[model samples]
Target: MSDTPPILVVDDQEKLLRLVVMLMNRIGFPEVEGVTSGPEALERLRERRYALVISDLEMEPMDGIALLREIRADDDLMNTPFILTEASFDFEDINVAHQAGADAFILKPFDMAVLKTKLKQVLNSKPRKREAPVAAESSLSNDFPMLGKF
Candidate 1:
């Protein structure tokens, strides 16, 4: 891994993904990557080490909740800071995301300043200890069923 912290942005919307990438760059994250689906996000995770993961809660095949669960279960990514974003601020949605292991939840139509603040907080938090690799293997069974529809 490079000295600069890597950030991963995951969303089904291509435009939003690009926008987040641009924003992170502007906000001073030197290394950033964006992906459009949960599977693609996992692929990226396996290939690199990221300091933070910002994902959208809703999507076609796999949602952010499912992605968060997978990340939490993986020993390598268990402590990775994950921020879940949603257009709606439904309490139930927030609760679900929390249960799935999201480090923070941000409502959509968000202000860049707020996002920057949250990013800084998460990035500044104590780093998690690296765990032994758990094979770096993912199976369909581990993925949410709804993801297949997409």
Candidate 2:
């Protein structure tokens, strides 16, 4: 295999997923993989190591914050860089993502330039190791009613 680590992109929308994967490839990420759901993303992560994970903020069953919490709780995958993307300017969502240990958050409709810059910054930076495991049942959803109880 090549020396470049692979990247995982998760999005419920197939078209968006394909577009993001294509963008990553065009940006020089040769090993970009896309998954349709949070569970599928987790399965992919367990199957192999990835340089980073770019996931959408809104998804059924498990949202980006929920997925992030799960990753943080797992010792093997906890330190992997994670970026959350959303289609809106919801400040509340951003705050929860930060609290959930996301490495970066990008609003949707971002240009290629913005995506490239954010990806480079996240991919190069070391993710902060959590001092304690994330709660199995995070009350973050309760705090953010709009996000629903994940």
Candidate 3:
């Protein structure tokens, strides 16, 4: 990835997805990309490197947590910064995401200022270069939300 790689924003809501993409581009990520589903987001990730991923917590087929888990399980993609958002999350849900290694969390409607700050933080997080061999693979599953209260 280059110094400032592109960004990916995932949300099933088209309007909010566009809004996030527009605002991110306005705030410095001119290559911001948006996808409406978790599967599409995964496909995009396989296609190119992304500086950050900002995803909504709720989605069909695969939610943000499932997307995050899949990303984490991939050795090539594990270090990418992830920022998950929601309207409001139950306390337990927050903890579950935290344990799963979310880089940042934001509650919507997004405050432009806070969003910018988080974007900067995650985009700037340099991945550690590892000389060691490939790490053990962890299985990917979409059962995260069940561990948390709705």
Give Cα-based local distance difference scores for all models.
0.76, 0.83, 0.80
Clashes of 3: 0
Question: In model 1, how large is the Cα lDDT of residue 28?
Answer: 79
Model 3 Cα shift for residue 51 (angstroms): 0.5
Greater-TM-score candidate between 1 and 3: 3
Alpha-carbon shift of residue 147 in model 1 (angstroms): 30
Which parts of model 1 are misplaced by more than 4 Å? 127-150
Candidate 3: list runs displaced more than 4 Å.
1-3, 126-150
lDDT of 3 by residue, 55-139 (tens): 9999998999999989887878888899999999886666677666677778899898888877677667767344553222221
Model 2 error, position 27 (Å): 0.8
TM-score of each: 0.80, 0.84, 0.80
- Compared with the true structure, model 3 gives a TM-score of 0.80
Q: Write down the worst ten-residue block by lDDT for model 1.
A: 136-145
lDDT of 2 by residue, 1-150 (tens): 679889999999999999999988898989899998999999999999999999999999898889999998899999899989888847677666767777776778668887887788788875665576455347445433345664
Descending-TM-score candidate ranking: 2, 3, 1
Best by lDDT: 2
Q: Where is model 2 poorest over a 10-residue stretch in terms of lDDT?
A: 136-145
Best by TM-score: 2
